[model samples]
Target chain A: MPAGASTRAGSILAKPDHRYAAVSILPSVLVVFAVVIYPLIYAVMMSFRDSRMGVLGGFIGLANYARLFSDVEFRLAIVRTLVLTVIAVALVIVISLGVAMVVNERFRGSSFIKLALLLPYALPGTLSALIWRWMYDPSYGILNAVLYHTGFIKEYVTFTGDPRTAMGAIILAHVWKFVPYSAFLFVAGLSSIPPGLYEAARIDGASSLTIFRKITLPLLAPAMQLALIVQTVFAVLYHFGLVYIITGGGPGRATTTLPWYVYSETFRFMQFGRGSAAAVVLALIMLVFIYVYLVALSPKERTVS
Target chain B: MRRQDTISGRRRRKAVWLALMTVLIGMYLLFPLVWMALSSFQDERVLQSRPPRVLLTPDIFTLDHYNFLLTGRMPETGIMVQAMYTMSGTYVLPSVVNSLVIAVTVTLGNLILGIPAAHAFARVRFRGNRTLFMALFATRLLPALSIVVPMFIIVSRIGLLDTKLALMVIYLAITLPFTLWLLRGYFAHVPRELEEAARVDGAGRFTVLWRIVLPVAKPGLIASAVFAFMLSYGEFPFALILTQSLASRTMPALMAGIGYYGSSRGMVAAASVLSFAPPLVLAALFRRQLIDGLTQRFE
Candidate 1:
C-alpha cells in the first residue's frame, strides 16, 4: 500500500479507541456533575433569591446573607458550632491518640480492645446518640444515677437538660463516635514509624514521654493533619438525627450546629433563601479553614510524596 | 543499688498510669452500651424510681419492658398500643429492609462503576486524567447538605421520591468518589510489570485485570467494599430527606423517630441493638480491612 493509504488506516483505527474511552468515562462524569455541581450552583442561586421549592419570587442579592449575619440565632449557631467542632475534634485527637498508643503496644487481646473501641463508629450516629440520650435522661439515666450513688452530686445531673451540659453532652457523643476513626489513623501513623527509631531512642536513655514528644508526634503529623481536617468538617456539620435524638438542639439551641440550623430554617421555617445562605456560609467557612490548613501543610505533603 | 531502685520505681509508676488510663477508657466506652442493655429489661416504674437502682445483675431485671416492646403495649402505663404498633409495623421492619437493600445495592454499584473508573485513571494514562481524578477528590469536599436540596428536587421531578431507588442513587453519589479515589491508589500500587508480562503472553487488558491485577488487589477491593457498605448502612441525611414512606425509610430514620421524636424507650433500645448488629458484625469480620481502607495510600 502507499504511505498515504497506511496513514489513513492508522487514523481510522485510532478513532474508535478514542471514542470508546470517552464514552466509558462520560457516565461517571455526568453523574458527578448532575449530583454535585448542579446542586452547588443551585444552592448559590437560591441564596440570592426569595425562593422556596418551586417559588422564585424575586432576586435579592446579598439580602439573605445580610439577614443571616443579623439573625441572632444564626450568629449563635455559628459560635456554638465552632465551639463544638474545636472541643470535639481536640478531644478526639487526644483520646484517640491515647487509645492508638495502647492498641499499638504489643499485648494480648489488643485486637479485641481495638474492635470494642471501634463499635461506636460502626453504629448509626442516631442510634449511638439515642443510647447516650437514654443514659443522660435525668429521671432514669444511668449517668445521674451513678453520680448520685457515688455521692458526687446530691441532686440529679441533667446532662442534656442544662445548657452548660447540653453542648458538652453533644461533644461527648461526637467524640465517642469519632475517636475510633481518629485512633485508626493514628495507628496507621504509628505503624509507619520504623521500630528502629524507638530502639535508638531507648538506647539513648530516652524515656517513653521523650520519645513520644520528639519522635512520635512529628512522625504522626500527617495523620494528625488529615484527622484534624476531616473531623473539623464532620464536627461542623453535626446533623439533625443525633442532635434531635439527644436534645433537639436544646435546652435552648445549645447544641444547634450549622447543619441543624440549616435544617430548621429550610424545613421548619420554610425560609429556603435564608437556609441556603446559612449553608453557603458553612461551605465558605469549611473552605477557608481547610484552605489555610492545606496551604500550611502543602510543603510537608510534597516532601512526603 | 540506688539506681536499680529508681528504675523499678519508675517502671511501677508507668504501669499504674497505664492501668488507670485503660480503666477510665474502658468505662467510658462500655458503660453506656451496658447501661442501655440493662435498662431495657427494667420495669417502667423502676426506671422512673427517684433513686435509680442498679439493674446490672440479671436478678433485678424484669421481662416486662421486653414483653411490652414485643407485644406493643405496656400494661403498666395503660397507654394504647396503636402508636407503637403503627411505628413498628409501618416503620421499623421496612426501614431495616430499606437500609440493607440500599446499602447492598450501592456497595455493588460502587464496586462495578468505581473499579473500572479507577483502573482507567490508574493504568490508562489518558489526557486530562490527573485533573479528572483531582476533581473527583474535590467533589468530596462539597458538603452533603449542599447537594441534598438539589437531589431532593431532582428525585421529585424524576418521580423517584420516597423510593429505595432514590436512596440508592443518593448513596452512590456519596460513596462513589471515595471508592474511585481509594481504588485508584490500590490499582496503581499493583506492579505494572505483571500487566506488561501478561500482555507479552498475548493477554488483553481485561484479561490482565481479571487474572493478575484483581487477585493482587483483592485486599484493597474488599476493604473498599466494606467501607462502602458501612457508610451506606449508617447514612442518615439522604435517607431522611429522600424517603418518606415506610417502605423506603431507613433504620437510622426509624430509630430517630421512635427514640427521639416518639416515646418508646424499650422498643427504641431493642431497635438500636438490632440496627447496630449488622455493621458491628461486618466491622468484626473486616476490622483489618477497615483500617487499611481508611489509612492506606491514595497514590
Candidate 2:
C-alpha cells in the first residue's frame, strides 16, 4: 500500500514549464552567436583595418580590398582555388554517384563496399593528408615503385614536388577523402526515389542508361546540389591541411591555393591586414555563388509550382 | 525459348561485369590505406628500396615502429624516437591522448548542449524560435578560415591559447550547428502522441523528454556523437592556429609537424597508421548508423 502510494505520488509533476524551453535553448544559441556570428563580424571589421602581430592598427578603409584586387598572387590564388574546387567537386560527384548507384543494387557484397566507401571520409583530414604524403614520397614512395614495376615509367615521379602535379595530387587526395560522404548522401538520395519509377521505365523497355538519365539523375538533383555546395566550400576553405602537409604550397608556390596563401601571408609574413582581406574576398566570392544559385533556383521553383 | 535463353545469358554477363567494376572501385578506394598499413609494418631498408617491396620477407618485417611508439624503447637500428623530435618536434602518444580528450569532450558537450537546444526547437514553438534557428543555421555558411583570425584573438585574449579547452570550445562551435540541425529533425519525427500521453499522466516536459524522446532518438544521438568526435578529431586549421606545442597539439597538428620534419618517411608512416586505426575501427562498427544519420531528412 505504501509503495503504491509512493508510485502515485511520484507520477505527479509541476506545471507544463514553458520556461523550460527557453532555458534549454538559450545557452547553445548564445555560444553559437558569440563564437560563430560575432567572430564573423569581427573578421569583416578586421579586414577593413590594418593589424600587426595581433594588434589592431588604425582603420585603413577600403585600401585592403583595393590592394587585394591589385595583388597578382591573390588573383592567382583565386583562379587556382577555383580550378581546384571545380575539379575536385566534379570528380567527387561523378565517382560518388557511380559508387552510390552500384552499391544501392543490394548485391551480395554491397554492404562491404558501402563500408569501404565511407572509410576515407571517416579519416581526419590531417591523418588523410599525412598518409597521402607518405604515399607521395618520391624516393621510397609506393606510387613510384608501383609505376616502375608496372613498366609505366623508368624514373620516379616527384608528385608533390613538381608544380604541374602538386595541385593534382592534392586534388586526388581531397576527392578520395571527401567522396564517401557524398556517396552516402547520394545513396540516401537514391533511396528516396520511388522504385516504381524504375519499374515503369523498365516495362517501357527503357535501357539502363536511359532509365538512369530520365529517372535516377533527375531525382538525385537536390542531393547533387547540396553535395556540390558543401564540397566547394571545403575545397576552397578547409584544404589547409592537405596543402600544408603534402606540398606546403611548394614548387615555387604552384600549389599555393588561397587558404595556404592566407596562412603564409598572415602568420608567416605577419601581414595580418592582407590576410584578413583575402579571407573576406574568399567569403564574398562564396556568398556570390550561394546568392546566385538561390536566385536562379527560386524562379524555377515558382515556375514549377 | 530462344528469347529466354538470350535474356538469361545477358543477365549472367551483366553480373560478371558488375563484379569486375566493384573490384576496380574497391581497389581504387582501399589502395592508399592498404599501402600505408603495409609500409608501417616494414622497417626502413624494406621501405627505402627502389621498386618498393610489395612482399615483405620475415627479415624485412619488423615491429620496431609500433614498439618504439608504444613502449618508448628505441630500436637497435633504423628510425629512432629521437628522430621524430629532432626532425619535426612530434611526440605521438601525448598528442593521441590530447586528441582523444578533445574529441570525447567535444562530443559530450555537443550532446549536452545541442540535444536540449534541438529539443526546444523541435518541440516548442517559442517566441523568436524561427529567427534563432535561422540565425544558427546561417552560421554554417560562413567559411571557417574567414573567422579564424578573430577566433585566434578571442582565444588568446581569454588566456586560453594552446590549451585543450580552447580546442574544445572551438570544436563545440564547429559541431553544434550540424548536431542541432540533424537531431532537430529526429526529435521532431518522434510522435507527439507519445509525449501527449505521457503528459496526461501529469509528467512534466523534462520527464517526457527523458522517458520517451531520448530512447526513440538513440540512433541519431549516437550518430551525432560520432560526427562530433570525428570532426573534433580531424580538425586542423584551428588547432594549427591555437596550439603551440605537443602539449596541446592533436593528431592532425602532429601530422603537420611531421610534414615539416620531412626526413623519416618510415616514422611518419607508422604515426599515420596509429592515427588512422581509431576512425577506421569506428567507421566499420557504426557505418550503418552514420549512413542513416547523414541521409536523414525531414520526411
Candidate 3:
C-alpha cells in the first residue's frame, strides 16, 4: 500500500472498527492463550511439587529443580541437548546454504534435484532414525558391509551402539533429514537477492568470492537468522523422534538429551516433578525468553513497512 | 581478450564443480531412501546376506511382507508371524490411516480457526494487536517437549488417552499457532485497496474476506493445510505417549515401535516405504505454493 493510503487506513481504523477487529481476533487469541498457557500451567505446577508415579504429593517448592540440577543424568542431558543442537544447526545451515546456492545456479535439470530435496525432510523422523539405524547396525547392516568391502574399517563397527560415536551418528541423521527444508529457506533468500547486484558486481571487475562475501552473504542475513533460530529450536526439541527411535537414549545413556531425560524421568521413572522441572529448566523456560526477543524483532516491522 | 578467455576457463571449472557437487549431494540426499525402498521388495535372506546384497531385480523380489501388512496374509514360518504374536507388530496400514485421520482433522481445525484470526491480524487495527500477534507467533516456537509431559497426563486423566481425539487437540495446539502466523503474513500481502473499495461499496467484512482476500491468499491456505497435515502426520512424541494401540496410534509411533522391536529388517523396510509416500507426493505437487508460502508470503 502507498504511505498515504495506509495513513488514511490507519486513521479510519483508529476509530470505528476496533470493535470489529476485537470480535474477529478474540477466538484466536483465546485459543492460543488457552493452548499454550493451559498445559504450561499444569507442567509448571507439577514441577513445583514432590510428585511420584502419577500421584500428586505436597508441593516441595523448587526441590524438583534442585534435584534435577544435582542429578548427573539431568545435567548431562542439558549439555548434550545444547551441544547437539548447536552442532547440528551449524552443519544443517552450512550444507543447506551450499545446496541452495547450487540449486540457484539453475543448471540443466536442477529442478529434478529440487524435487528430490523434499524426500529427506518429508520422510518421518522415525523413518530416518530407522533407516540410519540399519545403516549404522554393526552386523548385517549395509553401511558396515560397504565399509568392510571397501576396506574403510578393519572390522564392523557400531555407530549408534558405541558411546563415543553415538552422538556423532545421530547428528549425521539429523543434518541429513533437516537440510532440505532450511535449504529451501536459503533458496528463497537466494532468489530474493536482486540479480542486478550480481550483474553489476561482475561488471565492476569483482571476483566471484568477493561478490559472494560482499553481496550474497550480507543480503542473506535475515534468512540465516531465521534458519538459525528455527533450526536450533527444531534440533533441540524435535530430535525426540530421531533420538528415541535411533538410540533410545542409547547405549548406557550415551545419547540421552533433555527431551529423553524428560521422557524417562516423568514417564519411565514416573518422577513427574523432576521430569516437568527438567522440561521447564533445561528447555522451555530458556527458549521462551529467546522467542520473546524474536517476537519483538520481526514481521511487524516488515509488515508495516 | 584475456579476461574473456579466463571467464570461459572459470566457466569450464564451474561446470565440472557443479556436476560433481550435484551428483555427490544428490547421492547423499537420495541414496538411503532409494536403498530402503528397493530393500522393501527383497526377502530377508537377500537383504541380510553377507555384504548386504541390494537386489532390485524384479524376478528376485517377494511381496509377502507387504501382503502381510496390507492384507494380513501370514508370511510362512518366519519373523513376521512371531512379530505379530509377540510384539505389537506390523499395523502399518491401519496406523497410516490413523495418521491420516488425525492430520486431516488438525488441518481442518487450523483452517477454520486460522482464517478469521489471521484476517483480523492482517487488516484490523485493534488494541494490543502486535502484542497479541507476537505472543501467538512465540507460542508456535515452543516445543512439544514443554507441553508433552502435562499434555500426556491431562489426556490420560480425562480418559482421552488412546483416542484420536487426544492427538487431535494437542496437534491443533501444536500446529494452529504456525498456521495463524503464516496466514497473517500472507493476508497482509493481499492488497488492502481492493478490500477497502469493497467495504465502501457496501460488501460486509466477511464478504470482502471470502471474495477478495481468500482468492488472493489461496496459496497460503494450501501451504498452511499441507504444513499442518505433514507435522501432524510426522509427530511422534505426543502420539507415542498418548496412544497405546494401533486403533489410534499414528504411523510414526507405530513405525518407531516396529523399528525399536528388532522386527524383520525387510518388514521395517516395507513400512518405511509406506510411511513417506503421502508427504513426499503432497510436497512435490504443491511445490510452488509451499515455497511461495515461505518465501513470498514471508515478505
Top candidate, metric lDDT: 3
- TM-score for model 2? 0.92
Question: Model 1, range A1-305, lDDT digits (tens) per residue?
Answer: 12343344545234433443455456677776677787788888889998765465699999989989999999999898888878889999999898888877745445655766767777778788888888788877777877888999998888888998998988888888888888878887898899999999999999989999999998988888888887877776544566777887788888887878887788777788888888888788888878987888654443211
Off by over 4 Å in 3: A1-16, A288-305, B1-3, B76-87, B297-299
Writing each residue's lDDT as its tens digit, candidate 2 over B1-299 gives 99999989998997897798789879988888888778778776667667677776787788777766677666776444336423332477778888899999999999999988888789887567777786787677777778788888888899998899988988898889889988888899898999889988878778888889999988888888998899889888898889986667888887778734435556667778888777777777887788778667433
Query: In order, what are the TM-scores of chain A for the candidates?
Result: 0.89, 0.88, 0.87
Better of 2 and 3 by DockQ: 3
* Native-to-model Cα distance after best TM-score fit, residue B246 in candidate 1, in Å: 3.6
Ordered from best to worst lDDT, the candidate numbers read: 3, 2, 1
- Ranked by lDDT, the better of candidates 1 and 2 is 2
For model 1, the docking class works out as acceptable
lDDT, candidate 1, residue A30? 72
Backbone clashes in model 1, listed as residue pairs: none
TM-score of model 3 vs. true structure: 0.92
Write down the DockQ of candidate 2: 0.56
Reference contacts preserved by each model: 0.44, 0.72, 0.62
User: Which candidate do you rate higher for DockQ, 1 or 3?
Assistant: 3
Off by over 4 Å in 2: A1-18, A52-54, A297-305, B78-90, B259-262, B297-299
Candidate 1 lands at a TM-score of 0.90
